[model samples]
Target chain A: MAKKQLPYVIGCDGGGTGCRVVLADAQGQVLARASGGPANATSDFALTITSLSAALAEAAAQTGLSPQALRASVAHFGLAGVVSPAVAAQVAAALPFDHITVTSDREVAVTGALGGADGVLLAIGTGTIVAAQRAGQRRDAGGWGLQLSDQASGGWLGRALLEQVLLCHDGLHPHSDLTRATLADFGAPLDMVLFAAQAQPADYARFAPQVIAAAQAGDAVGRGLMQRGAAYLDLALKAVGFMPDEVLCLTGGIGPHYAAYLAAPAQAAITAARGSGLDGALWLALATARGLRGGAA
Target chain B: MAKKQLPYVIGCDGGGTGCRVVLADAQGQVLARASGGPANATSDFALTITSLSAALAEAAAQTGLSPQALRASVAHFGLAGVVSPAVAAQVAAALPFDHITVTSDREVAVTGALGGADGVLLAIGTGTIVAAQRAGQRRDAGGWGLQLSDQASGGWLGRALLEQVLLCHDGLHPHSDLTRATLADFGAPLDMVLFAAQAQPADYARFAPQVIAAAQAGDAVGRGLMQRGAAYLDLALKAVGFMPDEVLCLTGGIGPHYAAYLAAPAQAAITAARGSGLDGALWLALATARGLRGGAA
Candidate 1:
């Protein structure tokens, strides 16, 4: 009798805030899933490796497989902070699978969004990054990290909210209902808001929703920030070679909610990705197991 | 006979990028001046304090006065990052003057422009901040630092340049003479440009002039950035209880350069400060030496 073929593949999307893992078969059917925290290899290399390992183990456990069994399988990880060779090697070493591949989260996101075809992908999560693909060539825009770039990400939005609050506090911007709501959410005498802003980029980014709420509620400054955010994203997408009619896949939380801000042309180009990082990872795993190949054209 | 009173007073404006000390007597006489680097008390406390001390000492030295003799008189400092009591105390201690007063660079600028009257002041330098004063009550806007805020600043303009370059690189934004000029200035191979942006906020900010040049050259995106920078500054100014007929004082390097962006009301409010940070500082010191007389109120 012929030996039974392994029926599952695994994928992981590791980010600054968390790591998500998905187990799927060759047909793109989800077999299991798991999550863990703070796995951005660039920011916290050891933690990222540990978290990726744990998340993969958890997903395998859910699928009724041992770590060794999972190690024999193929896997792919779309990870944040995989921009350098060292980071990629560290992350690859952390995964359980033998046939493992790593790429910038943005690249995998573009691939997942376009299904390995040519297109533009705008990812605006805690940070913002845009990737464009044309005839197998890839281009990137923004995602310069929180300090000097990532203009339209959740981090950017959150920073905008805090800035508005500071403006209101200092009497440089109007105090709107949204500002009050945001202050209340942050629990402030205003100094607390400053502390939050000074603490971390991610801290401010967490309040991006409140800013969106304020914009939704008709605060002009808030609205302006949202409009600019959308414009910045459009600019980023355009940077990656988007044109009048190309499909632009909107990924990340802000991408879907803020879709209305894109121009008709950009909106027409916008579509949701069928799969996320997990799916991309799973696809990589199955491809590896089947000896699927990409050629240098 | 009463000792001949010195007809002019000296004013020192200390900031993050540079320091300027202006000698103007009681009659607004401009006598002598000099400039140097990074004197923002909050961002670079020691350096700024040292620079301030040195600039003042140097100015006095040029006039044949010993540092201690200059210390016998009063001086005031309108400085960046002097917002906190500790910073204020630190700056106060560093100065050689018998009486020295410290206040936010914003307050002194407004006072200098408005002659201690109620008005709004928009200051845009490496960072942007607005301050408004009415009936002795003061409020602030923007100026959260380079990473998260400073909308209409030199820094903002510079970042816009980088954004444009990235856009061009990715084919999102169009390339123009401005883009070519900026890339050339930065010696761009794309990665070199990226490396420069990654190096420091100031490095990016230095390119702001390119955007200004582009605006001058009729690049829509470049023009839009300048206009938007002005608009953001206007929004902050407007938030400060602006009245249609009220005066608005525009100060700082970018502030004066982008004066065209201010709305009519904001423009009407716009006036050049008679004294800069140094004058403001002198005023504060004089007021303190005079025992908090009627001037501040």
Candidate 2:
């Protein structure tokens, strides 16, 4: 008689930028991985499902398993824009898996950053996500977006820089090299105003590099903005209950840039991430598989 | 043989809320006045034109002048959302008048507040407009809008209050009565985030009264917000060249509320507006008529 085939598991990490999936055996050894287009659940639910399906299919193919066969596997996903339980349920229902779990991308990022250990994850890009995980319990602060929160985010930095330029134009604040360079980008102050009138967070975030560069060069306005951002980050770290001994992993496009500005204690606590978000999803999938077996027994 | 009719002039003050037109004689004596619907030029140019024309026609009718005869009048308008000369030109082209000058509503407000004399106008509502007029040379600071500026305006206060609530929610800040009350209005923190995602400046400004009341009741968060707003206002005043001796007229929905917050010197310098924006428009209309006669000679 043929030997019984081992059960499979799937892990998915989805974000605004792209969707990623990995396939593994019951023992949790990686079998295959694949990537697809953007999969922000809130922005485009149907597109997220599509992207996830395509990436999962590719990973299944890599493991020499049919899509139908893969549907019987355990799975877990950490996705951007899963703002509520209803969204998480919708995402879970859309995917074909015998057992699955869905959660906000922040959770998986923290898990991946700390490798399932108790620590903090500060993921700052066009947005900010400050999260802490202890003994599998997790909590997050900030990452509310550019409109209300995301205080120390790249988007916040860029928008604050533009605001400084306008203040200089109004003579309320003295101009620095950063502010002057920012003003030069516009035909006039009104042009900048018009641009800001319709600018989205990402559009504003495009200016973040200039701010970072100016701050590194000791531009007063840029340094002020960075200091402000750092202050907010410090608050967030404390709010999340970051302990001195716990790992502090700074990840994402703009996260590590803040190292120079972080408090000495936080800097001392920093550690390199062991895995990506995909690894966190895989870790969760394995846990789900174990739970299913335990229940069966 | 027939006595020459005194040249007619039309003064129109168009704002986001409504349009007001005053039919006047060459000497700036108001004959008839009428009001119409909203006339924010940038938001709806065609609608603004319609509103202005309707108000002007009503005023002309009250003054016993035919619409055609009224079209020959010298007109001056201070309209909301006239951000550029091109917008002003477009507004002027759409109106039926022989001689007309179109400018930002700020200019007319400053003129009316000080009765065309040298002074400062602090107009704070959903937006903030700080303008100084010295010997007819006028300068302004702030009033860019809620996104880029409007630091001390109602919209800013309300938005800042919401931000404080979120900060409290994240455990990054202590919640005072104001923040707690604001949070209670939402189903949950997520609901507040959803609301902010789609909120306009007016929606945020609706919360200003709560902040003001809480501040009056000695809420720490509210008091801090008010103090921050007052500081920005002081900076704006300095930016616009507001002199200690100059008459500082507080106008608009939220302007006088800051009297308690302003510096003693600024409070001492405060004066009631001499006339409304319509009066300032009428003054400009008279100036236009005089210029027309002088050019003809």
Each model's Cα RMSD: 6.0, 4.1
Span of 10 residues, lowest total lDDT, candidate 1 chain B: B288-297
The DockQ leader among the candidates is 2
lDDT for residue A181 in candidate 2, whole number 0-100: 81
- Assign candidate 1 its CAPRI class: acceptable
Chain B of candidate 2 achieves a TM-score of 0.85
- Once fitted onto the true fold, the runs of candidate 2 whose alpha carbons sit more than 4 angstroms away are A1-77, A89-102, A282-297, B1-40, B43-75, B92-100, B289-297
Give lDDT tens digits, candidate 1, residues A1-297.
775565467778776667898887756678788998766666567877888777777877788976677776667788876767776887777665577888878766766677778778887787776887888888788775665467778878877777677667666556887777767766753354346434454666777777777778887777888899888877666556679777787887676756878777888877768677666667667777676433311
Candidate number with greatest TM-score = 2
lDDT tens digits, residues B1-297, model 1?
665444335566766677888655454555567776777775667778677766766676667765555665556677776656777888888776665666667766766666677777777777776877788888777776665467878877887776666566556667777777766766754354346434444555677777777787788878888898988777776666678677676777777877776777777656656755556666665555455333433
* iRMSD value for model 2: 1.3
Tens-digit lDDT string for candidate 2 (A36-89) = 976768756898899998898788777788867787798989987788999999
Quote model 1's iRMS: 3.8
- Report the lDDT tens digits of candidate 2 across residue range B161-252: 99999999999999998899899999588888888878766678889999888989999999999989999989988888777898999887
Against the reference, the lDDT scores of all candidates come to: 0.70, 0.85
lDDT of 1: 0.70
